[model samples]
Structure formats: structure tokens, C-alpha cells
Target: MTKFYSLGDSESEQKRLLRQIDLYGDTRGVAFGAANRVVELGCGAGANLWIARQLSEGSYVGVDVRQGQIDAARRRTRDLGIGNAEFQLADAAETGLKAGDFDALFCRCVLIHQPDPRPIVTEAQRLLRPGGRGVFIEPDGPNHYMAPGKEALMKVFHARTHYAYGDGRGSPGAARNLYPLLVNAGFKDVTLTPHVIVATGDDADCCRAFLRHWMEIIAPVADALVAEGLITSRELKQALREAETVKPDLFICHTMWQADATR
Candidate 1:
């Protein structure tokens, strides 16, 4: 069965993920100092590959399902002269790597793509040594909102999310319920933190970038939604045009949750 992956493997998507790392890195709560061996599940294009630099005395491995992303990750790390990192093409839920081999595991924006995250959670637990730590960041899909009204954009978002929730894809709102999942999985020190992305007139460039990200999300899913009768082609065109014409004063806010646990 095929599922929808947001902003699929385009060269431009790689650049966008890199930019997203710059935008969200500071808040990522990854305790790199304590981690000697690290694994990043769903590590697209090595967006957070800089984590390798911080682990000068350690090693890092990035795993992703997309071969293009795995290849791009290797190329980017090699070209940038960043070492101590390896990229593997594998499904996050079942990476064929050794069990209990890593001391720390990090996942960002991965669970939202999994309709059932339990398998991935189990995999994370199995891969970590006793007392090993894991940090996961996932967006709060149902709660993301924009202010000052762009009804068309909202409609597109609704269509996109609704479509995503179908066809074996996971819910965008999966992050909020992670605590119980981790606890039930026997992970200790389970913690949840909420982070918000606020793009307003105060941060003009950031706001624009936020808008672009929002529109880019729609582009990939628009056709799927149309085919499913969730949206019309004309609606997609209008939404994209409105997205481009969004004013500098536009206000959009999104929320993501960070889950920290120990095996």
C-alpha cells in the first residue's frame, strides 16, 4: 500500500528541510552531550546532520525510507566535510540495525506519517540500550492555525489533512497523545513539551518562510485530494495564488510536541 509523504523527495524539499533545521534547531532539546551513539529515524536529507559535528567523540546514524534522501544525506555530509555520520535507507519502524546498540535515538516529524506509531516506538525501544534516551518531535496537526483569515488556505489545509488521515497514513495530531504511548511501551521518564511556531509581522522573513512552507505542503497533496473528491483543481490554483500573495503582516501559528523517554 502506498501512503502520502509530505513534500516528497525533491531536491528542493531537501533544501527546505535544511532551512527548517536552522529555524527549529535551537529548541530541539536533544541532549547531545550525554549521547555517545545516536540514531535519527526518518532523517530526511540529513537536515540535522550538524548533530554529527557536535558528536566529535561519538557516532551518528541517520535512517530514512527514501533512497533519494539517503543518497542526498550521504552526499551532503561528504561535501560539507562532516564526519562520524552514516546514512541508511530503511523504514523507521523496522530498521534492520542491531538491537540495544545505541545510547540515544532522535526522531523529528516522523510519527505524523505513521498511522500506527506503536511499531516505531517499539523499534526505538529495542534499538536502545537500557537507560538509553530518546527524543521525538512531532507536529500537532489538528491545532495548527493562521490568523487574519485566508479561508482558501484553510480549506486547502483541511482537505490536505483529511486526505492524509486516510489511506494508511497517520494523523497530523498524533503528537499530543505520545505520553501514554511511551508509558505503555515501558519507557521511563516520559515527558512532553509543547513548542509553538509563531510567524508574524515582527519577523518578516520568518513569516514569509512559514507561508512558503504552508503552500509547499499543499502542492504535493492537492492532486491526491482532487482525485479523492476532497478538493477541486480550481480550488488548488486559487489557494496557491493566495498563498503567494500573502501579505508580510500575515500571522500563522503552528504547534509541535516533543516527547522524551528512556528505555
Candidate 2:
């Protein structure tokens, strides 16, 4: 139950996530199209609600582990006058929702952070009714890049992919295992689409926004990483110090797998 996003509920972080929706959100998960009821796991800050609406005009139950995220989602739903939404504070793997209550299940950029994603996959299976669909989007952790040498960020990614953090499972690169995991969890009609995040110096806004994302993840875990000898305190300070002034020779991209399946 690691809130692996690690970026706490700050106004700046909220704004960054809102911008992330615009920059990276796509209709690739529209496999839930027209479903009558949906469940969105790890639905942080309700930014994805708009996209959720496009996929289905039905009621949605947004689930997350952090109370702050739940509050943020509720606040956004209220502010936007969105009527058919509800937010719950719960882990994705143990949602406490009734089984077979949803027509579709959705999560994006969620599973890779888990040390063992099997429980979440099984929970997704349990949440949906027969014939229900799910769209799970996860990144290729091993392929993520930030150019002009983002030393600290690169080290962080390397450590994650090398299984230095998890229970020797290396869940950061779990996107590659989605097919087998979902299949073994009793889901059918499994399909996967290749998704990519590509931002270059020309894409200034997205580049900076992505930089903010790196800082968000980096700053929170700097001390732990330093204590573990994975990163130095000086390197952590330098990374945070240069956050705003980081060179835009920045080229960022990562491969991702978007799995669409049925229960």
C-alpha cells in the first residue's frame, strides 16, 4: 500500500497533475466506452474525470489510498459541478467495494509502483461483472529517459528497475508482465497497445511539467535513497536546486503498455 506517487497533496503538485492530464492523457483507454458504471483506481485529484466522462457518462466511484487525494477528487467534482461521481479512500488492492458491482474498471500510471501488482489485478477481476472491461495503463520503467543527463533522476530510475527497492520483484517494470498477470487472474480477451511519452525541447510546457514530476518523486525519497547509499545528499540537493533552471535540452520519453481486457 505504498502511495508510490509520493508527491503529497500540495497546490503545486495538484496543478502539475492537472497539467499532466492535458499533456499525457489520451483516449487509448476508451475500451470502457458507454459502460453504465465505472471504477477508477488511484484516481488522484479527479483530473481524469473528464476523460472518464468521455469513456462513459455513467456514475463513477473513484478509489485511492490517500485521504488527501480523496478530498481533492471530491473537491474537484464539487467545483466542476460533476454530479455522477463519488470518491473513496481505499487501496486499489483492497477497495472494500462489492464484487461484480461495476461495468468497467480503469487505472492509469498506477500498477508499476506496486511491489506486487497481482492483488490489484485480482481486485480488478473481482470488481467487474461478467463481460465487464478494464483498461490498465502502465509505463516501461526501464526505458524512461531525461536527457542532458538528469543524473539524479536517471539514478532513481535505475535503482527502481534493478529491484533495489521492492521485495526483489522489480515492479517498476511490471508493465511487461501485464498480459500474463491479467490472464492468470481470470480475465479474458486480453489485449495490449503500445503507448509512449515523447517530449522534447520544442515541447517546452510538457518538458517542464515532466521535470516537475521528476522533482516531485525525487525530493520526497531523497533522504531514504541517500541513507541506502543509492544516491548522495549533494546529488539530491543539486537535482532539487536545478529543478526550475534545468536545461530544456531535455528529451523525455518512455514506452508503456495499455492493456484492455474483459472479466
Candidate 3:
């Protein structure tokens, strides 16, 4: 299996937390008051489960393929004295979880890494009870924006990074397929919502921080690109340097697609 970006690293963990806050904090009433069983697929470090705890009085189950992330999640829940959250090491596509048992299922930024997301969606449908809801969030890669001078280099970086995952078999633009996938998987009342992040002027610090975190996440991919003779070392360094130098007019728009449906 292809490895995800910067798994088990402090920087990646921080980025995950920031992303969770950015995505969930601004959106209100994400969980139902009556929800009693919730699950998260690819719940890296289980940050979202912690967030879910605040929204619903549910017992939470988080599943990830990485043992290291599972260990970290276990420690995090234990340290927080949360008794209702459980972490398991398992594949998202075939989690072996009970069928028709969960009240809600959530996944974020995970389906893009899969070469075919149908299995995961199918599994989600199976996992949810009748009238249960499923929420999925993923990036529409082609719509990602950056400052004028940095767009081309970042595009190249993204393309090379996508190629690194399963030799280009992964879908970098998986967000666009969420609606059709959910519908095809027998979900009803599917709805799509787009969340676009555009930072400018006073948000320069936030933009810089976001870009820096991305750089850190992709550093290993940059090294792999060089080793594969896909990009020159100097080119990678130049791109990194440009990302580090923030300008007042710096702007980036990342549009994430969120799809929700009932099983």
C-alpha cells in the first residue's frame, strides 16, 4: 500500500488539527442530538472523534490503517479521559465493522488517496443503519489556487505527488465524484456543499502557515520526485523557498467538496 503524506509526524498531526477546526468549527450542527453511534473512516489521530464527542452524546469508533496513528489516538483519548471513543487499526474499504449499526459515518480527505473509492462508499452504506447519514469531504484538486507565480510550480508538485501514490492511479480530484459515488452506492437524498478557503491581506499569516504546513507534508514527496528523476533538486528548493516567502497580496483558494446522504 502507498503511504500517506507525513503520517505520524508532529507537523502532520498539527495540520490535521488545524484542518479539523477549519472544516468543522465554522459549520454548525454537524451531528444529530439523537445520534448514539458514530464512526469515522481514516480518523488519523482521532481528532474528529474528539470533536464529535462535543456535538453528540454518542460512542465513537475511529478506524485507520496505520498502527502508529491508532496508538496515538488511543493515547489521546486516554489522556483526555474520554471513555466513549475507541480506535482500531483497519482498512477503510473493508472495516469488518457491524452492518446497519452506526447512526452516522464521516470521512475527510481520505477517498482521494484510493484508486477506486467505490468499495469505501459501499462499505459506508453497509455500515449505516436505515435513515443513517454519511458525510464525506474531499478536495477537488484541479480547483486549488495559489499566488500567481507559484501556481505552475505547485501544480507540478501536486501532479508528481499524485503520481507517487499508486503510480498515478489515485484520484487527486476525488471530491467531484462524491455525489455520483454516493448515489450509485444506493444512498438517498444526497447533497453536495462546497467549502472554499480564500485568504488575503489580513489573513497573510494564516495563508503562510497553511502553505508551510503543506510544504512540510510534501517534503518527503519532493525527495521522492528527485530520486525518481521527475524534478530537479534545485527546482524543489526554489518552490519551497517561494512558498516560505509570503507577500501581502498572497492568495490561495482550496475548495473542498462535502457530500451528505442517507442510507
Best by TM-score: 1
Model 2 vs. true fold: TM: 0.85
TM-score per candidate: 0.92, 0.85, 0.88
Per-residue lDDT tens digits for candidate 3, residues 39-59, read: 889887766754456544578
Name the lDDT of candidate 2: 0.76
lDDT of 1 by residue, 69-150 (tens): 9999999999989879998888888899999999889988888888788888899999999999999888876777875656
The residue ranges of model 1 lying beyond 4 angstroms of the native Cα positions read 25-28, 247-249
Q: Tell me the tens digit of each residue's lDDT in model 2 across 197-221.
A: 7888787777778777766655555
The alpha-carbon deviation from the true structure for residue 159 of candidate 1, after best TM-score superposition, in angstroms, is: 1.3
Looking at model 2, residue 43 earns an lDDT score of: 90
Q: Order of all candidates by TM-score, from best down to worst?
A: 1, 3, 2
